[model samples]
Target: MIRVLIVEDEPLIAEAHRTYVQRVTGFVPVGIAHSGRAAMRAVADAAAYGTPIDLVLMDLGLPDTSGLEVAAALTGVTPSPDVIAITSARDVAMVRTAVAHGVVLYLLKPFTFAAFRDKLDHYREFRASLPSNNDTTVSQHEIDRALSALRTTDLRASTPKGVAPQTLDEISRAVRAAPEGVTAADTATNVGVSRITAWRYLEKLAEDGLVTRRSDYGRAGRPKTRYLWKTKHAN
Candidate 1:
């Protein structure tokens, strides 16, 4: 299995990344770090213990320092782990800098399970295409094939059938606006939809990993199910 380390400042987001990593067949989340320093310590400790991490799912907005700085520092360590940047930043200059700092892949925020899985799967393919022996010299065709494995098609058009993108956007906005979480009824009122309609969309969001579901038992009678947006995103 490929060992992975999750580095995100937010506890919930870090846990979500850990869960997502575990869901992939060949990946295992070995640790989670909430800061750049913690991430460096975890990587060093893993190396010291003789079980070095193979990959890092790095979040760019680290509290202690920029995630790009962390990535650059990580490269100085022997047998550095590959980084796949997971962030909300879309600045072209940031992307260029991340590439210079050795980020193998870039995944934007508010992504679904399908999109996340696509990236991991592509990385696996890329790794598989590489030569197993360190001393082996690769040909031009072999190099091309390995690099091609990292390419991914656009997944923005991949929403499930019967779900309108406009309505999904509205539901996402409503959930993000409510940091405390929202019930289907609350979402319905906010989005101008029926309770049942809101429930269906919320379920789809939960299934896609964009939102999390929990039971609210404080109220009388049956517990109400609430859905929360997984991360904070710009409107």
Candidate 2:
């Protein structure tokens, strides 16, 4: 599981964020800290327990300390937690500093559930592409795919002409909602699109490492293509 530590001052908002993390596949909400000091302690405690946090959902404005300072402190720790700033901070200079400290994703406040899910899903793909155990030599394609998965947010940007983003998002949600996976035809039926159109979106997701594609040969003239949602810690 991708263990997450949510750092938000507001109790209601923090609870909502925790719930959101739980709803997503491959992610587990391990703890919530209401301030920067508590967040630091949580990270240390997790490390001491031998199950360090994978990500920190941090808020920029905290009563005690700035989130950026916490992020900078985390950078000095061994096996530091990856940060995704979930705040309303819109200052360009602060954003640049956050990037310098290795914040992987920046999510502005007042985002919808769909937007939040997209960021987490993207992170999952990027994490799955990396070597889980150790540092090792990797091919250029592997490196490129990993980086692209981390940076790419708009699926429409990479789709070939004629594929609509709205339809692609619908197809993605359908596949993700099915734990047992979905076939192209089934996705088409669910999303009210043609099988060919659904297949195109599925193929794109599979290529992007967001979903796993396999062949089902039982009771088939030609083997059927099956796609499943990639689960926790799958590499």
Candidate 3:
């Protein structure tokens, strides 16, 4: 399992991340740090336990110091956990720096669970293929496929070894097949991905003008937002 540390200050967002971690197959949240100082403590404890943290889902907007600064400090460790920026900020310069600091992924905020899970699953695949049998030299073809497939925006070739094409089909079918409209949470459950991944797709659909958002009402609790596929136009 990949041990993940979350360094987000917002309670709701942090809880959402924790929920996503629980839902994924091979991810475990080691701890949460609300501040950079607190983040150091959390990392120290996890490292002291010997497992350390395999990855960190960090928010760029931190209350204490810049998220990049925190990442810089963390990456200075002997064996740094791959940092995945999970923030709403889309500053290009900051992102460039993040890439330089060894961040494997950058996920924009307000994403669907499906998108988030897709990225994590790819990361898992990439890590799993690293010298599983170290006695022999790794083949170039194997290394190429591993790197190509791990990209969040890229799709793995059609095979049972990777995510099947039917998964995306199922998600589209689930939403288009809905009698009315599907909530982000429901779409994720139906697609077998996380809500964040599902939401990311929904956002893409929204941007493309394929799906229109309508506030779902008449339910007790938080009002559900439904993404209805546009019949007249494609998003």
Per-residue alpha-carbon lDDT of model 1 for 49-74, expressed as tens digits?
A: 88988899999999999999999999
Overall lDDT per candidate, in order of appearance: 0.86, 0.86, 0.75
What's the lDDT for candidate 1?
A: 0.86
Candidate 3 per-residue lDDT over residues 29-75, each given as its tens digit: 97888888888777777777777898889888889997778888886
Q: What's model 3's lDDT at 132?
A: 42
Off by over 4 Å in 3: 132-143, 154-235
TM-score of each: 0.66, 0.73, 0.63
Leading candidate by TM-score: 2
| Per-residue lDDT over 67-119 for candidate 2, one digit per residue giving the tens place of the 0 to 100 score | 98898898766668999998888899989998987888899889877778889
